[model samples]
Target: MAHKKSFEALDRTQQDLRGNSELMGGALVILFGDFRQTLPVIPKSTPADEINGFLKQSFLE
Candidate 1:
């Protein structure tokens, strides 16, 4: 699984490239995963921090 920040960064980049301030630049983004199955890894961080980094916890979600 990818970090929430990673998705946010991609959204920003895509928006900049497409010149649109929309989600993923209005592009269709299909994400496949089970949050219960996997979690993002944050080295030396607490369990709460890792949970907060989940995609489901992201603004896009």
Candidate 2:
């Protein structure tokens, strides 16, 4: 979340830095990422491999 003015990126592997002190501190924060880059442990999850994953097993189907 480098684009965000008040974002704090977790080290993931190591914990050296924390908090949003570079700019003004705020309460609102937004994060977006690709869900496709996840574990392939799901043996029978049809929606996971399909292009319409979110809608494949949804109630709207």
Candidate 3:
């Protein structure tokens, strides 16, 4: 698998998403990390790891 890039460095892009919420949706808000903050307990393996885990266990098995 290819090494994944971090979106942490793209905090500005998330800010743009928030600023454009009307163009996005009242339903969604995007956010980026504060590198000053600690990392997750187990670092994520991929951008979709958390969601994929839930879906695989719950729906697709």
Best by TM-score: 1
Q: RMSD in angstroms, all models?
A: 1.0, 11.8, 12.6
TM-score, one value per model: 0.89, 0.17, 0.19
Instruction: Give candidate 2's error at residue 16 in angstroms.
Output: 17
Residue pairs with clashing backbones, model 1: none
Taking the tens digit of each residue's C-alpha lDDT, what string does model 3 give over 1-61? 1111233223335547666433222334354445233233326466466333332223211
Predictions in order: lDDT:
0.91, 0.32, 0.35
- The C-alpha local distance difference test score for the whole of candidate 2 amounts to 0.32
Runs with alpha carbons beyond 4 Å of true place in candidate 1: none
Worst 10 residues of 2 by lDDT: 1-10
RMSD score of candidate 1 (Å): 1.0
Order of quality (TM-score)? 1, 3, 2
Question: 1-61 in candidate 2: lDDT tens per residue?
Answer: 1211112232221223334343223233343564345322334656535433432233322
